[model samples]
Target: MITRILLAVDDSPAAMASARHAIELAACLGARLHVVTVVPDHSLSNLVTRMGSHPGVHERRDQAAEAILDHVVRLARASEVEADAHLLEGDAARRILAEARSMHADLIVVGRSEGLDRSTTAHILEFAGQPVLVVPPEVR
Candidate 1:
Protein backbone atom coordinates (compact mmCIF):
# COMPACT_ATOMS: atom_id res chain seq x y z
CA MET A 1 0.00 0.00 0.00
CA ILE A 2 2.50 2.57 -1.05
CA THR A 3 0.70 5.88 -1.01
CA ARG A 4 3.64 8.23 -1.25
CA ILE A 5 7.13 7.87 -2.64
CA LEU A 6 10.02 10.27 -2.28
CA LEU A 7 12.83 10.32 -4.81
CA ALA A 8 16.12 12.15 -4.46
CA VAL A 9 18.00 12.99 -7.63
CA ASP A 10 20.85 15.09 -8.99
CA ASP A 11 22.50 15.74 -12.34
CA SER A 12 24.31 12.44 -12.31
CA PRO A 13 23.57 9.62 -14.75
CA ALA A 14 22.86 7.28 -11.88
CA ALA A 15 20.23 9.65 -10.55
CA MET A 16 18.58 9.75 -13.94
CA ALA A 17 18.27 6.00 -13.91
CA SER A 18 16.85 6.13 -10.40
CA ALA A 19 14.33 8.74 -11.48
CA ARG A 20 13.10 6.55 -14.30
CA HIS A 21 12.61 3.61 -12.01
CA ALA A 22 10.82 5.74 -9.45
CA ILE A 23 8.44 7.10 -12.06
CA GLU A 24 7.58 3.64 -13.30
CA LEU A 25 7.12 2.28 -9.82
CA ALA A 26 4.95 5.16 -8.75
CA ALA A 27 2.74 4.71 -11.75
CA CYS A 28 2.47 0.99 -11.21
CA LEU A 29 1.58 1.30 -7.55
CA GLY A 30 -0.72 4.27 -8.04
CA ALA A 31 1.40 6.23 -5.62
CA ARG A 32 2.07 9.91 -5.65
CA LEU A 33 5.66 10.78 -6.47
CA HIS A 34 7.61 13.46 -4.71
CA VAL A 35 10.82 14.48 -6.41
CA VAL A 36 13.42 16.57 -4.62
CA THR A 37 16.76 18.13 -5.43
CA VAL A 38 18.82 19.63 -2.65
CA VAL A 39 21.18 22.46 -3.29
CA PRO A 40 24.01 23.47 -0.98
CA ASP A 41 23.26 26.21 1.49
CA HIS A 42 24.81 29.53 0.62
CA SER A 43 26.37 29.99 4.04
CA LEU A 44 27.85 26.51 4.01
CA SER A 45 29.19 26.95 0.50
CA ASN A 46 30.81 30.22 1.55
CA LEU A 47 32.58 28.51 4.41
CA VAL A 48 33.84 25.73 2.16
CA THR A 49 34.77 27.93 -0.80
CA ARG A 50 37.89 26.79 -2.60
CA MET A 51 39.80 28.19 -5.59
CA GLY A 52 38.05 31.53 -5.18
CA SER A 53 34.73 30.56 -6.75
CA HIS A 54 33.22 33.70 -5.21
CA PRO A 55 29.97 34.15 -3.30
CA GLY A 56 26.38 33.40 -4.29
CA VAL A 57 27.30 30.09 -5.85
CA HIS A 58 24.17 28.69 -4.29
CA GLU A 59 22.07 30.82 -6.62
CA ARG A 60 23.30 28.95 -9.64
CA ARG A 61 22.89 25.71 -7.77
CA ASP A 62 19.29 26.62 -7.01
CA GLN A 63 18.55 27.20 -10.67
CA ALA A 64 20.07 23.86 -11.53
CA ALA A 65 18.07 22.16 -8.82
CA GLU A 66 14.86 23.67 -10.15
CA ALA A 67 15.60 22.46 -13.62
CA ILE A 68 16.29 18.96 -12.42
CA LEU A 69 13.12 18.80 -10.39
CA ASP A 70 11.05 20.16 -13.25
CA HIS A 71 12.35 17.51 -15.59
CA VAL A 72 11.73 14.71 -13.09
CA VAL A 73 8.20 15.84 -12.32
CA ARG A 74 7.39 16.05 -15.99
CA LEU A 75 8.59 12.52 -16.53
CA ALA A 76 6.61 11.24 -13.59
CA ARG A 77 3.45 12.89 -14.87
CA ALA A 78 4.00 11.46 -18.31
CA SER A 79 4.21 8.07 -16.72
CA GLU A 80 0.70 8.68 -15.29
CA VAL A 81 1.86 9.23 -11.75
CA GLU A 82 0.65 12.10 -9.67
CA ALA A 83 3.81 14.02 -8.89
CA ASP A 84 5.27 17.14 -7.31
CA ALA A 85 8.71 18.66 -7.20
CA HIS A 86 10.70 20.34 -4.46
CA LEU A 87 13.87 22.41 -4.49
CA LEU A 88 15.56 22.31 -1.13
CA GLU A 89 18.56 24.14 0.30
CA GLY A 90 20.88 22.46 2.79
CA ASP A 91 22.89 19.31 3.21
CA ALA A 92 21.57 16.86 0.62
CA ALA A 93 20.99 14.00 2.99
CA ARG A 94 19.49 16.16 5.70
CA ARG A 95 17.06 17.84 3.36
CA ILE A 96 15.99 14.49 1.93
CA LEU A 97 15.32 13.03 5.36
CA ALA A 98 13.37 16.10 6.40
CA GLU A 99 11.26 15.97 3.28
CA ALA A 100 10.47 12.31 3.74
CA ARG A 101 9.28 12.93 7.27
CA SER A 102 7.31 16.01 6.31
CA MET A 103 5.65 14.28 3.39
CA HIS A 104 5.11 11.04 5.27
CA ALA A 105 6.64 9.14 2.44
CA ASP A 106 6.32 5.38 2.54
CA LEU A 107 9.61 4.89 0.76
CA ILE A 108 12.74 6.75 -0.33
CA VAL A 109 14.51 6.08 -3.63
CA VAL A 110 18.02 7.15 -4.51
CA GLY A 111 20.73 6.46 -7.06
CA ARG A 112 23.44 3.95 -6.27
CA SER A 113 26.90 5.41 -6.70
CA GLU A 114 29.60 3.34 -8.32
CA GLY A 115 32.55 4.25 -6.19
CA LEU A 116 33.13 6.81 -3.44
CA ASP A 117 30.34 9.25 -4.27
CA ARG A 118 27.40 7.81 -2.39
CA SER A 119 27.46 9.88 0.73
CA THR A 120 23.89 11.07 0.50
CA THR A 121 22.52 7.58 -0.10
CA ALA A 122 24.62 6.22 2.72
CA HIS A 123 23.37 8.86 5.07
CA ILE A 124 19.77 8.26 4.12
CA LEU A 125 20.07 4.53 4.64
CA GLU A 126 21.73 5.06 8.02
CA PHE A 127 19.26 7.62 9.34
CA ALA A 128 15.97 7.13 7.54
CA GLY A 129 13.17 5.36 9.36
CA GLN A 130 11.47 4.27 6.15
CA PRO A 131 12.46 1.76 3.52
CA VAL A 132 14.88 2.86 0.80
CA LEU A 133 15.45 1.68 -2.76
CA VAL A 134 18.85 2.29 -4.34
CA VAL A 135 18.57 2.04 -8.12
CA PRO A 136 21.64 0.73 -9.86
CA PRO A 137 23.39 2.69 -12.57
CA GLU A 138 22.22 2.04 -16.10
CA VAL A 139 24.59 -0.09 -18.11
CA ARG A 140 25.85 1.61 -21.24
Candidate 2:
Protein backbone atom coordinates (compact mmCIF):
# COMPACT_ATOMS: atom_id res chain seq x y z
CA MET A 1 0.00 0.00 0.00
CA ILE A 2 2.91 2.30 -0.63
CA THR A 3 1.05 4.77 -2.77
CA ARG A 4 3.16 7.76 -1.79
CA ILE A 5 6.95 7.73 -1.42
CA LEU A 6 9.12 10.50 0.02
CA LEU A 7 12.69 10.54 -1.13
CA ALA A 8 15.27 12.81 0.50
CA VAL A 9 18.22 13.24 -1.77
CA ASP A 10 21.39 15.25 -2.23
CA ASP A 11 23.85 15.45 -5.13
CA SER A 12 26.17 12.76 -3.91
CA PRO A 13 26.80 9.58 -5.83
CA ALA A 14 25.05 7.55 -3.17
CA ALA A 15 22.10 9.89 -3.32
CA MET A 16 21.89 9.47 -7.08
CA ALA A 17 21.94 5.72 -6.59
CA SER A 18 19.11 6.04 -4.11
CA ALA A 19 17.20 8.11 -6.67
CA ARG A 20 17.49 5.31 -9.18
CA HIS A 21 16.26 2.76 -6.67
CA ALA A 22 13.41 5.02 -5.67
CA ILE A 23 12.34 5.43 -9.27
CA GLU A 24 12.29 1.68 -9.76
CA LEU A 25 10.39 1.11 -6.55
CA ALA A 26 7.82 3.76 -7.38
CA ALA A 27 7.26 2.32 -10.85
CA CYS A 28 6.94 -1.16 -9.44
CA LEU A 29 4.46 -0.09 -6.78
CA GLY A 30 2.59 2.35 -9.02
CA ALA A 31 3.25 5.06 -6.47
CA ARG A 32 3.88 8.77 -6.80
CA LEU A 33 7.27 10.15 -5.84
CA HIS A 34 7.85 13.24 -3.77
CA VAL A 35 11.43 14.33 -4.16
CA VAL A 36 12.84 16.74 -1.62
CA THR A 37 16.13 18.52 -1.12
CA VAL A 38 16.99 20.69 1.84
CA VAL A 39 19.28 23.66 2.16
CA PRO A 40 20.89 24.48 5.47
CA ASP A 41 19.88 27.67 7.17
CA HIS A 42 21.84 30.91 6.89
CA SER A 43 23.42 30.74 10.33
CA LEU A 44 26.67 29.32 9.03
CA SER A 45 26.83 31.84 6.22
CA ASN A 46 26.12 34.67 8.61
CA LEU A 47 28.93 33.57 10.87
CA VAL A 48 31.29 33.22 7.93
CA THR A 49 30.27 36.59 6.51
CA ARG A 50 32.58 38.26 9.00
CA MET A 51 35.48 36.40 7.40
CA GLY A 52 34.70 37.64 3.85
CA SER A 53 32.23 35.07 2.53
CA HIS A 54 29.49 36.44 0.29
CA PRO A 55 25.91 36.88 1.46
CA GLY A 56 24.50 34.68 -1.29
CA VAL A 57 25.69 31.44 0.21
CA HIS A 58 22.20 30.46 1.20
CA GLU A 59 20.93 31.45 -2.25
CA ARG A 60 23.52 29.24 -3.91
CA ARG A 61 22.50 26.37 -1.71
CA ASP A 62 18.91 26.90 -2.65
CA GLN A 63 19.76 26.84 -6.34
CA ALA A 64 21.75 23.67 -5.89
CA ALA A 65 18.91 21.99 -4.02
CA GLU A 66 16.47 23.02 -6.72
CA ALA A 67 18.73 21.63 -9.41
CA ILE A 68 19.02 18.32 -7.65
CA LEU A 69 15.29 18.07 -7.10
CA ASP A 70 14.66 18.91 -10.75
CA HIS A 71 16.94 16.14 -11.86
CA VAL A 72 15.26 13.67 -9.56
CA VAL A 73 11.80 14.64 -10.72
CA ARG A 74 12.84 14.31 -14.34
CA LEU A 75 14.18 10.84 -13.73
CA ALA A 76 11.09 9.74 -11.86
CA ARG A 77 8.78 11.04 -14.54
CA ALA A 78 10.91 9.47 -17.24
CA SER A 79 10.27 6.20 -15.47
CA GLU A 80 6.54 6.95 -15.90
CA VAL A 81 5.91 7.60 -12.21
CA GLU A 82 4.15 10.70 -11.02
CA ALA A 83 6.67 12.98 -9.31
CA ASP A 84 6.82 16.32 -7.59
CA ALA A 85 9.79 18.30 -6.31
CA HIS A 86 10.25 20.32 -3.15
CA LEU A 87 12.94 22.72 -1.96
CA LEU A 88 13.08 23.15 1.77
CA GLU A 89 15.16 25.22 4.12
CA GLY A 90 16.22 24.48 7.70
CA ASP A 91 17.44 21.31 9.42
CA ALA A 92 17.55 18.61 6.76
CA ALA A 93 15.91 15.88 8.79
CA ARG A 94 13.26 18.10 10.27
CA ARG A 95 12.27 19.55 6.92
CA ILE A 96 12.23 16.15 5.28
CA LEU A 97 10.05 14.63 7.99
CA ALA A 98 7.70 17.59 7.84
CA GLU A 99 7.40 17.29 4.07
CA ALA A 100 6.72 13.59 4.29
CA ARG A 101 3.98 14.09 6.82
CA SER A 102 2.42 16.93 4.89
CA MET A 103 2.45 14.89 1.72
CA HIS A 104 1.03 11.81 3.47
CA ALA A 105 3.89 9.63 2.41
CA ASP A 106 3.70 5.94 3.24
CA LEU A 107 7.44 5.39 3.26
CA ILE A 108 10.64 7.44 3.44
CA VAL A 109 13.77 6.74 1.40
CA VAL A 110 17.18 8.31 2.04
CA GLY A 111 20.70 7.93 0.72
CA ARG A 112 23.74 7.46 2.93
CA SER A 113 26.80 9.22 1.65
CA GLU A 114 30.28 7.85 2.14
CA GLY A 115 31.16 10.82 4.29
CA LEU A 116 30.63 10.92 8.07
CA ASP A 117 27.62 13.19 8.20
CA ARG A 118 25.04 10.55 9.00
CA SER A 119 23.15 12.91 11.27
CA THR A 120 20.23 13.48 8.87
CA THR A 121 19.66 9.80 8.17
CA ALA A 122 20.11 8.91 11.83
CA HIS A 123 17.66 11.56 12.88
CA ILE A 124 15.06 10.30 10.44
CA LEU A 125 15.53 6.72 11.59
CA GLU A 126 15.15 7.79 15.18
CA PHE A 127 12.14 10.03 14.72
CA ALA A 128 10.23 9.21 11.55
CA GLY A 129 6.73 7.90 12.21
CA GLN A 130 6.73 5.81 9.04
CA PRO A 131 8.94 3.05 7.76
CA VAL A 132 12.26 4.29 6.34
CA LEU A 133 14.24 2.66 3.56
CA VAL A 134 17.90 3.66 3.63
CA VAL A 135 19.97 3.21 0.50
CA PRO A 136 23.52 2.66 1.63
CA PRO A 137 26.65 3.80 -0.18
CA GLU A 138 27.62 0.24 -0.94
CA VAL A 139 24.41 -0.15 -2.91
CA ARG A 140 25.96 2.08 -5.55
Best lDDT among the predictions, by candidate number: 1
- Against the reference, the lDDT scores of all candidates come to 0.89, 0.88
User: Candidate 1 local accuracy as lDDT?
Assistant: 0.89
Q: Please, what are the lDDT tens digits per residue for candidate 1 over residues 38-96?
A: 87767766765654756666666778889999999989888889999988888889999
TM-score of candidate 2 on Cα atoms, chains taken together: 0.90
- Residue 60's C-alpha lDDT in candidate 2? 74
In terms of lDDT, model 2 sits at: 0.88
TM-score of each: 0.88, 0.90
After superposition, the stretches of candidate 1 with alpha carbons farther than 4 Å from their true spots are 44-56, 114-116
Candidate 2: tens digits of C-alpha lDDT, residues 3-40: 99999999887788889999999999999999988878
RMSD of each: 2.2, 1.7
